[model samples]
Target: MSPLIDCLLIGLGATLIMDLWGLVRHPLLGMPLPSYYLVGRWLGHMPKGQFRHQAIAKASPVPGETLIGWLAHYLIGVSFAALLLLITGSKWLTSPSLTPALAVGLVTVLAPFLLMQPGMGAGIAASRLPNPGQARLHSLITHGVFGLGLYLSALGLRLFN
Candidate 1:
């Protein structure tokens, strides 16, 4: 298969795993499922020069924000997978290992810590959250799972070849 096709499969597989984790975590732990609609709303406002919000929850809803956010979520997942391939080179995709996948996944947490969280008014690393430590821990774990997803997905793809 072409590298691009491989990457897409790997990315989609990894994102699916992460989403599955969310589904399992929500009902069991009472953790709310991530609202992609809010993400869409946030992105929708970017062209209007509204990047940051005191509280995205209070922000006006945008049309099709749900779809936009979900699309962005998957795209971001794919981009991260591509980043992993870039860092480790295409050779890694053939063999598929754990360390690099986990490293990339853990590293991705910086996006939310610095940009997403702050942009949404949660403060850096979710400092403004009711339970900042817990929230940060959740983010860390979630990203770590994403990393595992990367490895698992790669492994799955390897089986087909």
Candidate 2:
């Protein structure tokens, strides 16, 4: 596969794995699924020059925000995968090392910490949340899972090869 295609698959797969963790975590730990719609809503407002929200939920509803959110979620996942590829190179995609994948996943958490969470009014690193430390912990774990997914996805591709 082309490097672009590989990056896309790796990203989508890792994001899906993180999402699965979100689903299972809800039942196992009583946490709620991530509201990507809020992300969409945030993005939706950006065209109007709004970059941050005091409370994204209270922000006006945007048309197709749900679809936008889901699409953005997957796209962001793919972007992170691209970042991983940039760091590890496509050659690594062939062998699929867990360390590189996991490291990328862990580093990807910075997006939410520095950008997404704060933009959505959750505060940096979810500091605005009632339990900021717990929220941070969950975010870290989810990103780690995403990293694992990157390695797993590459392995899956190798199986087909």
Candidate 3:
């Protein structure tokens, strides 16, 4: 398969795995599922020149915000997969490694820490959160899982060859 196709599949697969982790964590760990709707709401305001929010949930609702959020979530995943491929080269897709995947996964957390969370009014690295350390831990673990997904998805795709 072409590298582009590989990236698309890898990104989607990785994102799905992360979502599954969220599902499992909820019942087992008592963490609530992430609200992508808030992500959408934050993006929805982009056109209006609004990047940061005191509280995204309090922001005016955007039409189809939930759908927008979900799409963005997947697109972001795909983009991150592309980043991994870029860093390791397209050839890496044929023989994935855990170290690179984990590195990329952990690095992806910066987006939420520096951009997404702050845009949604959560502060840098969720410093504004009631329990910032726990939140950071959750984000770290989630991103790590995403990295694993990247490696696993590549391996799975190889099976089709």
Candidate 4:
């Protein structure tokens, strides 16, 4: 398969794995599942020149925000995969190593720590949340899982090929 196709598969696979982790964690740990609708709501307002929200949960709801958030989630995953391929080269696709994939996954936490969280009003690295430490830990673990997922997905794809 082409590099683009490989990236898509790996990215989507990794994202799906992360989502599954959330599903399992929610019931087991009493953690609430993320509402992508909020993400969509945040993104939906971008065109209107709105970027930061004191509390995204309290922000005005947007039509089709759910679909928008979900789509954006997958697209971001795919983009990450492409980024990994770009950084490590397409040769990694055939070989499918764990180190690079995991590294990229871990590094992706910066998006939420610096950009997403603050934009959604959670503050930097969720510092403004009630339990900032716990939230940060969860983000770290989730991103780590995403990194593992990247390696696992790459391995699976390599095996199939």
TM-score of every prediction relative to native? 0.97, 0.97, 0.98, 0.97
- Candidate 4 lDDT score at position 103: 91
Which residue window of length 10 is worst by lDDT in model 4?
A: 30-39
Q: Which segments of candidate 3 are over 4 A away from where they belong?
A: none
Candidate topping TM-score: 3
Q: lDDT per residue, candidate 2, 1-161, as tens digits?
A: 88898888888988888999999999899999766888889999999999999999999999989889999999999999998888888799779989999999999999999999999999999999899999899999999999999899888877876
lDDT of 1 by residue, 7-64 (tens): 8998898988998998889998888986688889889889899999999989998989
TM-score of 3: 0.98
Task: Tell me the alpha-carbon RMSD of every candidate.
Answer: 0.8, 0.8, 0.6, 0.8
Instruction: Indicate the residue-level lDDT of 145 in model 2.
Output: 96
- Model 3 alpha-carbon miss at residue 118, Å: 0.6
Task: For residues 41-121, write the lDDT of model 3, one tens digit per residue.
Answer: 999999999999998989999998999999999999999999999999988977888999989999999999999999999
Per-candidate total of colliding backbone pairs = 0, 0, 0, 0
Any runs in candidate 4 off by more than 4 Å, and if so which? none
Alpha-carbon lDDT, every model:
0.92, 0.91, 0.95, 0.92
lDDT of model 3, residue 19: 96
Candidates 2 and 3 compared: the better one by TM-score is 3
lDDT of 4 by residue, 13-33 (tens): 999999999998999999999
User: Total backbone clashes of model 2?
Assistant: 0
Shift of residue 67 alpha carbon in model 2, Å: 0.6
